[model samples]
Target: MRIIDAHQHFWDLEANYLPWLTDKPVNFRYGDYDAIKKSYLPADYRQDAQEFELAASVFIETEWDPTDPLGEVAWVNSLRKRESLPSVMVAQAWLDRDDAESVLAAHGQTDFVRGIRHKPKAASAPGDVVPGAPGSMGDPAFRRGFSMLAANGLSFDLQTPWWHLPEAADLAEAYPNTQIIINHTGLPADRSDDGLAGWRAALMRAAECPNISIKISGLGQKGKPWESAENRPIIRDTIEIFGADRCMFASNFPVDSLVGTFSTIFNGFRDAVEDFTPGEQQALFHDNAARIYRIDPTREV
Candidate 1:
């Protein structure tokens, strides 16, 4: 099917995104985007999607850039100069900032800046919910910042563990107009502690929120000995419960590539979506992104 990867990330290895790709001791640079140059860019991602039909990709923020909050926005802006790259961007922001409205307004002016991701962790450590550890998203100040998102015509890409369902739910209720996408299946929860049932319950709740959407991404496929076939079900269940209109497909790319190939990841996403009709597939892979992000594929920029 024709595809529009709703959630992917790119890091210019030799440019501004390089510093964030350091070793684990200092930074979280371990076989991530920059390290895997093959399918991390428009040209490369397109080439990598040769096995499948990937028409475009939405580039999400790799991480926060302290010196430049607009670093990801700048990256996509630069790409627009070079190529018709990264159709959309889910950039980062200090949601706790009082100037959050202006911050989003400025960034939203950038052609590809379509969404915001403030890391929030709802699970214990050893889980994939790093960056913002335990209860960072629960802060009321962050909720206030989120309130301004939809007003500026930007969506919020939520990256919290499944255990943080109540918190994610609260954010959705608080900002009824804002669009929130559950990142990485609530980060897979803690396999040893929270267990699948708890995560599943949280996911079921996430599906209920009208303003909330879930991106079917296999980025968190590993952390276990299972293969794509095994991991596909969790994401598939999410889609099946959430339904096609509420669900979208994504690559999560290099981060996911650490677990499987780009094609493999997309294929896993495709596999989960196999039951979806052709039109449903279109919605999942292309139209959903275009509609939700208000993507103007014909726009020159």
Candidate 2:
């Protein structure tokens, strides 16, 4: 089947300054990301995704140097000029920062940029959530910067945990014109029964906002390999909650590669939705991303 990978990344560690990959390792959820610290440009990604019918991919920001947000967009634009695989990008921007407007304007000037990703301040656990905290999604200053997206014709790529989905829902409600694409199924790393129950309820709340959509990627467990049995239920539930039109499939490649091969994740998604009609499957794999990200699948860029 044809595909538009909704969320993936490419980084040149030697040429670019990705502090997370270069500096002393931070407490990464995937644990010890040293394996992927090396450059993963278009060629490397193509090799890993060679078996799949990948029509195009969206390059989400790889936490490039925070001081130079536009620098990352420029580098991705350069890559697109030569490689043409990442048809579009979700560039990095800190919504709560002082330079947010100027940075967002710079990104808007780039033709290939479709959206912005700023992982809002999240509570460590569900109970710790404090609404309207500074830098959190509800922060007045953050929302002030977020309000700028609609005028720029850019969407928001949110990567907060599921516990924060209520805040996400409120943000979506407040900014109905600005599309909010939830990354990684709201980062549902907890798979226990109560955990999933909370996740499902939170997802349902986010889905109620018509402007919100979700990418079903980054389902990797800390120690376990990416398996359909472990993720199929979550995948199916996400699609059910958001519906095929609002949901899309993604590799979350290189990062998810820590858990399994490209085929393992994509194939598992395909298998999980095998019983759905071809149209629904098409939306999940290809259509939703193309429409949501404003990608021209036929253009080959």
Candidate 3:
């Protein structure tokens, strides 16, 4: 099937100081991430995704040098100039920064930047209801920074764990005009029945806001084995809660690669949605991402 990978990352270890890849403590949820610590540019991504028909992709910002957020954006745009695969950019920004407006303005000046993903989650105890810095989202300054997105014509890519989905719902309600794309299926970190129940309920609440759409990606981040049958309920429930119109699928690549191959991830996604009609499948794999990210038409997959 044709696909528009709504969420992927392309990083150059030599050009940028990515703490996650270099000599610094990383906050990734999964273990043994050493396998993917090397650079992952568009060429690597294309090779990984070659088994499937990948129409386009969006370069979600990786953890780069926060000192120069625009630098990472420029680097990715430069890559796009060479390879047209990653057709959209979701650059990084510190929403709580005092000069966030200037940063947002800088990001706005870029050609492919369609959104901003301010890191929201902070390290927290396992089984903690709200992981990450809970107050960051509601902080006056952060909200101020978030408020600037609509003015700059950019959407928000929320990367919070499941516990924060309720607050995300409230944030979405507050900014009815601004688009909020929830990352990682609301990040269901807990796979237990009770955990899934909580995630499902929170997702339903978030979906109540028409402006909040969910991107189904990053499922294997928490050390779970990549299996389509195991993910069917999560995928189906997310689509059921948000409806297929407000949902999109992504390869989450490189990061997800730590757990499984590109074919394993995308093929699993394809299997999860096998019961849906072809049109619904089309939306999950391509149309929804293209429309949400404002992807330009390119050569057909």
Candidate 4:
């Protein structure tokens, strides 16, 4: 089936923003010495996606240094100039900034920018989710940024820790006009903790919003196992709650690859919904991303 992965990331240590990679697992180092480097240009993602026959993709920002939003946009866009990148970039710029328009304008200079995401769940320090943080989805500054996106016809690629789903959903409740796409199905876990049950319901309600879409990527990549067939039901529950039209597939790549292969991550998705309709499968793999991000997979990279 034709596919459009709505999420992917690329960073080079040569860039000022990439010092963050040293903190990442060795698998994610893009170009650091004494670390495994990632060849994360469009060619790399394009090659890995070849087996799945993806038509296009949306790129989300992995680095979130809010200190320099415009600089970050220019930096990521610069990568596209250096090589033919396949996906549109979702910059993690200051949606909450008073200058949200200018920040987006910087990204708009490029053909690849599709959206923005500054995950609230991120700990100020790495390796854990921070509770009660102001993620880009709901901050007043983010409020203005989201408006900038809607005005520019861009989507918001949202990633939050498991705790903030209800608040994120509450934000969705407030701004019905925003084209919100939930990252990692709001990141449900195999073993529930931290008010996960309530988070699931919040996500379900947000899915009911016609404007919202969900990226069914990044979950297993966060490191979980199905153990047996019993764990398969979570995917079903997501589909039933969000509906296939509102769901799309993504690799979240090297990050998710930390836990599973690209083929295994995707095949696991196929396994999750083997019983669903081919059309549902189509939406999950490609159509939803194309529709939500407004990129043609058939376009030349």
Point to the candidate with the largest lDDT.
2
Provide the TM-score for each candidate, comma-separated. Answer: 0.85, 0.98, 0.94, 0.80
- Per-residue accuracy of model 2 over 153-264 as CA lDDT, tens digit each: 8999999999999999999999999999999998988888999999999999999999999999999988789999999999999988999899999999889999999999
lDDT of 1 at 195: 73
Candidate 4 lDDT over 1-301, as tens digits, reads 5667777776654545554555554432122233224445666666666777666667687674667765666766666566646456787766665677887776666566777776553532223444334653455665666666666656677776545555667677677777788887676653455445655776776776777778777665233442225335556777788888888878786566555567777777888888888888888887777778877544535
Best by TM-score: 2
Residue pairs whose backbone atoms clash in candidate 1: none
State each model's CA lDDT, in order.
0.70, 0.92, 0.83, 0.65
Model 1: lDDT to the true structure: 0.70
Question: Taking the tens digit of each residue's C-alpha lDDT, what string does model 3 give over 1-301?
Answer: 7788999998888778887689865547767778777888878988898888788888898978888888888788777778875788899998988779999998887778999999675435335644224346766777888889998989999997776777777788888989999998887877889888888988988989999998998887456677876777888899999998999998788888877889998888888888899999999899998888888886333
Model 4 CA deviation exceeding 4 Å by range: 23-39, 64-67, 71-83, 108-110, 121-138, 193-196, 221-231, 297-301
Clashing pairs in 4: 4-286, 55-297, 89-112, 96-141, 96-142, 120-135
- Which ten-residue region of model 2 has the weakest summed lDDT? 25-34
RMSD of each: 3.8, 0.9, 2.2, 4.6
Candidate 3 wrong stretches, greater than 4 Å = 25-27, 121-135, 221-224, 299-301
Which ranking of candidates, highest TM-score first? 2, 3, 1, 4
Q: Per-residue lDDT for 1-301 in model 1, tens only?
A: 6777788776665565444455343313222344454325667666666787666677888774654677667767788677776777888787887667778888778767887888753445424444344336666677677777877788888876576776677778877888888876676634544577777788888777898888877445333322566677677777777888877877777666666677777776677767778888888888887787777877422
Pick the winner on TM-score between candidates 1 and 2. Answer: 2
Worst 10 residues of 3 by lDDT: 123-132
